[model samples]
Target: MSETIYERLGGEDAIAAVVDRFYERLLEDDRVAHFFEDVDMRRQRAHQTQFLSSVAGGPVEYSGEDMQSAHDHLDITPSDFDVIATHLAETLVEFEVEEADRAAVMEAVAGYEDDVVTVAAD
Candidate 1:
């Protein structure tokens, strides 16, 4: 069988590093920082790391809220989602993830957009 993206990306440690950098970029971006204002970043970072690990086919399990329920009250817009996705992609690039792996990750993230963005319901 082919290597899982998690394995290809160096597993949990690498996923944690990417998630850390991703949040750093998100926090620095005024456009997306507001969403995290009330968040406990340490816990948020841990959730994200595990979430990404699972998405990449790692051993970790995501015990956090489901995507839609998690962001339903946040009123996230398509543009906001795009900015976040860009940060994620950039974070992957910063970590030197292979093109295919990066693309795969972004694609997986994109699949959650409808569940994440709630602008129309606002």
Candidate 2:
């Protein structure tokens, strides 16, 4: 087996940083702000960090609800998901992540699409 992509992302601290900044951007982003309007950003950020860390194969364990259950009532659209993916990609670039590793992160996110964002087409 190869080193998990999470290790390449610098483990928990790195994943935490990435998630923090990603949420910050999302909060300020007009395109995505509505989704979080009723959320407690502090808790949301923490959950996101744990989720990303787990997804990246880090040692941290995430105990939050599954993606579908977490976002099921939100009525998220493909455009909303697109906005999120863009922010994630931009955040990774801002952190100077390598193209290959960034691609890995994007690929990992794809696995959650069906769960996180349920579109009519899906």
Stretches > 4 Å off in candidate 2: 1-3
- Give lDDT tens digits, candidate 2, residues 4-121: 7678888888888998999889989998888899998889988988888877787879899988999999888888998899999999999998898888878988888989887664
Candidate that scores best on TM-score? 1
Candidate 1 overall lDDT versus native = 0.92
Predicted candidate 1 versus true structure: per-residue lDDT over 1-122, tens digit per residue: 99999999998988888888899999999999999999999999999999999989998888999999999999999999999999999889888999999998899999999999999632
TM-score of each: 0.95, 0.89
Error of 1 at 121 (Å): 10
RMSD of each: 1.6, 1.9
Error of 2 at 55 (Å): 1.4
Candidate 2: Cα lDDT at 84: 93
